[model samples]
Target: MAKLKSLMSCAANRLQQASGLDQTEARIEIRALMQHSLGGVNHAWLIAHGDDTVTDALRVRFESLLARRIQGEPVAHILGRREFYGRDFAVTPDTLIPRPDTEILVETALDRIPPDQACEILDMGTGTGAIGITLALERPHAQVTILDYSEAALAIARENARQLSAHNVAALHSDWFSAVQGQRFDLIVSNPPYVEADDPHLQQGDLRFEPITALASGTDGLDDIRRIVAHAPMHLKPSGWLIIEHGYNQGEAVRSIFSGHYFANVHTVQDLAGHDRVTLGQLT
Candidate 1:
């Protein structure tokens, strides 16, 4: 009978040795696995239960999860949930895992749309409905619609909205602006595929398990961004905002695309890491 603390230590050591993850990340991953197996308990619970004996069945389950982590499967995918914008969003292989950087896009959108305003918001390429659902929940008066190209992705987004009880959110299946023809919105936001087709990072770590269509854009990784910037103006009302989350190094190119399209107030904002992550423009 292994103790909980010993099991966690051994698992963290195995992950650090086999997955090339540093000690801190390995520990974090081990803690996440423990939390998953222990009924979503927090780290404090783990600390309090460190002396508890691990049953054979539970140990086997934890080991299985550890094996998946060693295989480069994302902890979010393994646990089936990811916390974003102070909420836990359901996740699956069908959709991109909701990332912390995307919260910036949500925050920016919330800042733009006032709480009392009853407006329409569109979240293009919404995977897991994190952005649109967050907006809807944050501003209950706003009518939020999230569109995805993949039906599987749309299903996950819809289920997330249902689970979160976000009544203001609606999920639709569309490739970009195709399905929303003639429907103008007060705000349009997306965290589209912005990674280069051949980017080396795609072959590494968690990206290996994520859907390629949700990550890679084009040769320079600006294909989807360009398409969105070109088409969003038509779907956005005059003075409406279009906010997009892109690769860290894509600020200049994205801003240029916005400028070429004659968008007003075009600008790029950095994430918590000081890397440019989101770019926005207004259709004037």
Candidate 2:
């Protein structure tokens, strides 16, 4: 059996060569693969045993997962979960992988919600229940409705809610507002599909593996965003808020959609990248 450190180093180098990840990122991915293949052990365990020898079974499982990573599969797909807002939420190809930038949407909405009140929130396109579940967990008094068009995605969302103990939320199947026709919410948040259908990025990297419907909208990528904004006024309680995530370059268009829909306090929030990433507005 190879030493754990040697095995990790070899796998990391191979992954880096295959995927173009830098040394540090390659090592991190290898570490995550190790922790998972070793049956969900924590990072400290890997640190404590860095000098240990790898068991044959562990070597086999780790190498198998590493091979998948080398083939460009997302680590979250291999591990079956992704961390968002500091929580590991279950994920699958059926749902969009929870990304760090989406946390900005969560934080922006979380800051707007009063902690002690029974705020009603609707998370449209809640793929893994990351947004709605995090909101419900953060503001326990808040009741969040997690809606998705895909039943498979909604199943993942529901499972994530239960696994995370986010009891204050409900997962509903809907194509946008189809299932919630007249239901008004104190806040409506969405990380909708905003990538243009023909965008070349869709053919590369992790995008290659994610569901297309969760990533692309219409030709300009604003079709779903427009639909969400156009129908938001009916679902939002007067004086309530609407927050949505979009492509960094599409902020101005999203803000215009909100403004044209008569949403007041319309504005866009930039993620850490200084790119406009989230747009929010309030109902008059």
Candidate 3:
């Protein structure tokens, strides 16, 4: 009992020192780690109870995790999971961490597509299957196909799909539409790599641990968004909607890309934070 208490105190101290997280945030995270059965609960509970004698082995492991977190490793990567659109998804270094801004994209897509209609939807660059899987779960009758270039990313996405029981989603290893040549969908959505290659943010926080292929587009960061806009019309049914998430400042550029095509209703949607984060257009 004393050992458990000591370990918890040491862990909390190390986490606080390493990450500069206040007592409340650190305690909350530690509690979640315990609740998730990561084997730290007994120590945490004992520590909270004022026990102070912990084993060397447990101390070493806890310190290691604290060090990693202090280095800016995302908690999601450390835990191997993230919650997106009210669903938990398996995440890894191979894919991008699903962001809250992207939820606006999913919500927008759900609003645009008719739930009762048996429509085909395509999710391009579906890292962790968050967008595609959510759509499949919400619109069971909709046939959803998720395409990603990286095999490792696709593997994680497939696992997320299975875990969520979203059977209607088809995971495809493709660079955009290359593998699914003749197939088309009633709606196409993507939260593709829109970060500029040399963006300073890429060197910081969770982005540091994410795969570059899933984050950086090109010099201007519009490379992937432009490609999706240019090619989406080819894979979208007439009158279908193509929605995309981009850097807050890229909305106008994305909308212009759509205007150059046969797409109509070209516009942008702001996220809850009031950033122009999503752009949508309909195939005419």
RMSD of each: 1.1, 1.0, 3.4
Error of 1 at 26 (Å): 1.7
Pick out the ten consecutive residues of candidate 1 with the lowest summed lDDT: 32-41
List where candidate 1 sits over 4 angstroms from the true fold: none
Report every candidate's CA lDDT.
0.93, 0.93, 0.84
Show the lowest summed lDDT stretch of 10 residues, model 2: 1-10
TM-score of 1: 0.97
Candidate 3 lDDT by residue in tens digits, 165-212:
998999999988898788878999999999999999998767889999
Candidate 2 structure quality by residue, lDDT tens digits, 1-284: 78888898999999999999999999999989998998998889888898998888888899899989999999999999899988999889999999999999999998999999998999999999899999999999999999999999999999998898899998889999999998999999999999999999999989999999999999999999999999999998989999999999998888889999979999999999899999999999
lDDT string for model 1 (230-282, tens) is 98888998899999999889899999999988699999989999999999999
Candidate 2 has what TM-score? 0.97
- Which regions in candidate 3 have their CA more than 4 angstroms from the true location? 1-28, 36-61
